[model samples]
Target: MSALGVVGGVLQPLLVAAGAPLLVGVMRQVRARLEGRAGPGVGQPWRDLRKLLRKEAITPRGTSEVFRLAPLVLVATTLVVAVVVPFVTTDSALDPVADLFAVVALLALGTVAVALAGLDTGTAFGGMGASREMTIIALVEPTLLVAIFALSVRVGSTNLASIVASTLHDPARVISPVSLLAAVALIVVIVAETGRLPVDNPATHLELTMVHEAMVLEYAGPDLALVELASAMRLTVFLGLLANLFLPWGIATTATALAVLGGVLAFALKVTLLGAVLAVGEVFLAKLRLFRVPELLAGSFLLALLAVAASFFLA
Candidate 1:
């Protein structure tokens, strides 16, 4: 890591922590407005976090250490990702420490922590949610890896920052069919991974229907706050990665102060716009039945596979 990279790594978490709540709140507010209701404003997520923090955490009787540890692990893993991935600038200090494969592994670790915690509680609902989440992850992970493989194959590196820098240096890469197909597969993964519409509805409380909510239904107070914050950060990190990877034009390549500032502004705008697009997309799309989700993801997987084939065959 260059000296500037160290500074960037330090600042990345603070930026992510500050912006995640606002992004989540914006998506919620926008979606609500689309649904014809006066939704909670963009400040709502921050308020919700504050309200949860002030309350006491109450763990249930049948839980163990895993239950208590999972929330912290979840937040910690996501914080590492926020620090390593090129959020605002392509000059990533932690680049070698966690490449694209490492990023996926860290996220998987967080998922495992939560899933184990869910199972540890032994609640029927928790088990059901964990089972469903694991199933989805199993199906989606290959597509995620395949999509990355396609991008990396095009750029000749698995490092995300390198890929972005390479793609920016070669404008023709943006128009490649491999890039488009990979992006389509990735967008679908983002929808599924973030528990958004047409997959698992984040806002729903239907006992038999909600996948993400059911796992954390037993959490309250500070623990719940941590889980919620980590979830928001996860979505933010994903969107930031998507923005930076596909639209690398405005990202800062150097550590100059003014350049960094521009990169930050550009990244924020890109991610916020992505969030708005997803929120609006959700307004028109209905959530699919649980069984149907696999079919949708199966299509995504095929697209990703084709993306990989195109990169190797067409190139």
Candidate 2:
């Protein structure tokens, strides 16, 4: 790879890691405005990160080392996953190994680690959250894989870069009903996976209703910051995948400077529009009861399976 390529690879994660929190801030701002409340500044997340970093970490008396380490693992896994995803460009250094299945596996690994750590804390809330989280994952992952398989069938490859390349090579594929179904299924998966509205509420602290938040209730200081950052990055990564894989309009297939810049702008625009849609969705919907989450995910799974069948018959 050229020096610019190497540099671009290194910068991708940094940009995503930083941009993730900013995206959260923006979403919050939008939500606040819709709710007629003045939101915290867009830089609020950065301030929170800095404050968390400076505070001393406190572990519960009975907590194991795994609890202490989970935050670091969460951040590291998110960073690694972000690098593997085709964000600004398809020429990721890690693209060769970026199989869609492997990406799903990595995400599952991170989820399991966090859930285990949550249960390790011996808190009722943490354990409850972990249970809910695993249940959601069980319902969501299959649908995610099925959606990806739908795309894989069209592109004839499971590698994400290849999928993007195939779609770019034939833009008309996006308008197919199979593509539309897959996109819809993936969007639902994204909402469920990212702890957004109608599935889980990211803004709530209620123990009974909070799945992701309950799991991290025991985390404090730098550990909490890392987990929070990881959550944001995870959201960004999934949305980025949805944008680039389906759209792929301006994503760079080669390591050219102008192409990279165009890819960056296109990426920002896509994610911003997605974030706005998410905000509006949250505004219009209430969080589902824990029991109802499974039904929602099941519908997504069926849509994804239908998408696959459609691709087979139509493509």
Candidate 3:
């Protein structure tokens, strides 16, 4: 691996893992400010995780190792994506394996692991949450794949680094019909995948409406902390991908220290801005009914399809 790749591989995951909680805190604080409420401070998530780590570990009766391992798998998959994706630099450590399909499959594996963990619990809420999560994932994975695939079509490569590097070279493509449609499609799927507003509310714990929370209702202590941290990292990863793929202006093309530092700063600013925008928008939107979520995802898939068509016809 190149020196840039090695540096970025180490820096990117560390940044994502540490900053993920801060990102969540920022979103929550933004939403709270908009709604005229006193919000938990931006450090609150980090505080919560620290507290959870100190608590006693608990495993529910009758649960299998799936319940024990899902959190680790979820975190492991997200960290792998962080290391491989072109967030801090245009190059990545595992560049050869950074194919779009591989990254997407890694993400899907994490989702499946969590769902299986829910099923292993054998509780009514866990089963219901798993079923609902599966339903959402069925729609989400396709839109995500096709949407990113739309971008890959133009570059003639499925490797994510190549696509980002291509966009970095030709910035105008960001305004093309293909990019716009794919951006919208990606944003929708990111929302769904991260359990955000208008799909699944991160703050809601009402058994009747919660999707992600219900699945982890049986978890406590360190396992719960891992799940929560993994969820936050997934959000950061999705936002980082969305930002860098379409707006790769400040990413480092060189291996120099100054360039890499600038890239990291730019990445943080862009993702924070996007997170704030999402939070503000959520204040104005309500959760869609469970059955209607597929409709929204379907709409995103249609946009991605049109984008793919446009990429070919307009090329």
Candidate 4:
């Protein structure tokens, strides 16, 4: 890799970590506009992070060390995942260790850590949220894996960079029915995994309706900020994968300076459009009852399975 390419790889995760909260802010603004209400500015999430960082951490009396360490683990895990996923191009520096399966495993590890921390707080709400989160992960993860497998089968590898490269080599892959179905499955997975509408409401402070927020209720100060930022990063990572993998029209395959710039611009445009679509979906759909979550995930699973089968048979 050239010096610029090396520098770009080093900066990739930081850019993703920073871009995530901004993405969430933009989605909120879009949703507000769609609902005919005044919206917070796109920089709102940044302000929140700054404020949270300046506050003091207040640990629950009954909490264990896991509670204090969870945020750090969460943030680190998310950064690792961000590095693994190719946003602007298919030549990530971490590609050797950034297999699609490894990415999923790291995500699961973070999820488990956060869930255990939630239970460690000894709060009924926290435990309940943890239970709900585990349930959702159990249902959603398989769908995510299967959808990825659909793409992997077509490319003959489980590496995200390879998959993106292969897709770029054959532009016609974008319009395949299997690709479309996988995209749909991934969208549903994104909404559910990111704690968005019809799955969990990020805006809600109500304990009964909160999944992610409830789990982090005891976290404060920088710890809270880390957890929140990690959640935002998770959203960005998923959307980036969805965009770059399925519709990687403008992504850079070469290490040229001009290609890198174009790739960055293309990445921004794809993420912006995806965020807007998510915001619109949230505005139109009501949050599903917690019990109904299983049904929604089940539908996604079936679609993903069909997608995999179709790709195997057709692509």
Best by lDDT: 3
lDDT tens readout by residue for model 4, 110-209: 8888999999999998999899999999998899999988989988899988888888989898889888888899999999988999999989879779
Off by more than 4 A, model 3: none
User: In TM-score terms, which candidate is top?
Assistant: 3
In candidate 2, which residue pairs get closer than 3 Å at backbone N, Cα or C atoms, i.e. clash? Answer: none
Sorted on TM-score, best first, the list reads 3, 1, 2, 4
Candidate 2 scores a C-alpha RMSD against the true structure in Å of 1.4
lDDT per residue, candidate 2, 64-181, as tens digits? 8889888888888778777777777776567665788888888888888899998999989989999999999998889999998898997788988788878889899889888899
Cα deviation of 266, candidate 2, in Å: 1.6
lDDT of 3 by residue, 1-315 (tens): 888888889999999999999999999999999999999899999999999999999999999999999999999999999999999999989997688999999999999999999999999999999999999999999899999999999999999999999999999999999999999999999999999999989898987679999899999999999999999999999999999999998999889989999999999999999999999999999999888898999999999999999999998
What lDDT would each prediction earn against the true structure?
0.88, 0.85, 0.95, 0.86
- TM-score per prediction, in order, is 0.98, 0.96, 0.99, 0.96
Q: What lDDT tens digits, residue by residue, belong to model 1 across residues 81-168?
A: 9888887777787878558889998988998899888898899889999999999999888888899789999678898888888887
Clashes counted in candidate 1 amount to 0
Prediction 4 TM-score vs. true: 0.96
State, as a TM-score between 0 and 1, how close model 3 is to the true structure.
Answer: 0.99
Off by over 4 Å in 4: 1-8
* Candidates ranked, most accurate by lDDT first: 3, 1, 4, 2
Q: Model 4 scores what on Cα lDDT? A: 0.86
Q: Pick the winner on lDDT between candidates 2 and 4.
A: 4
Better of 1 and 4 by lDDT: 1
> Which ten residues in a row are the worst by lDDT in model 3?
200-209
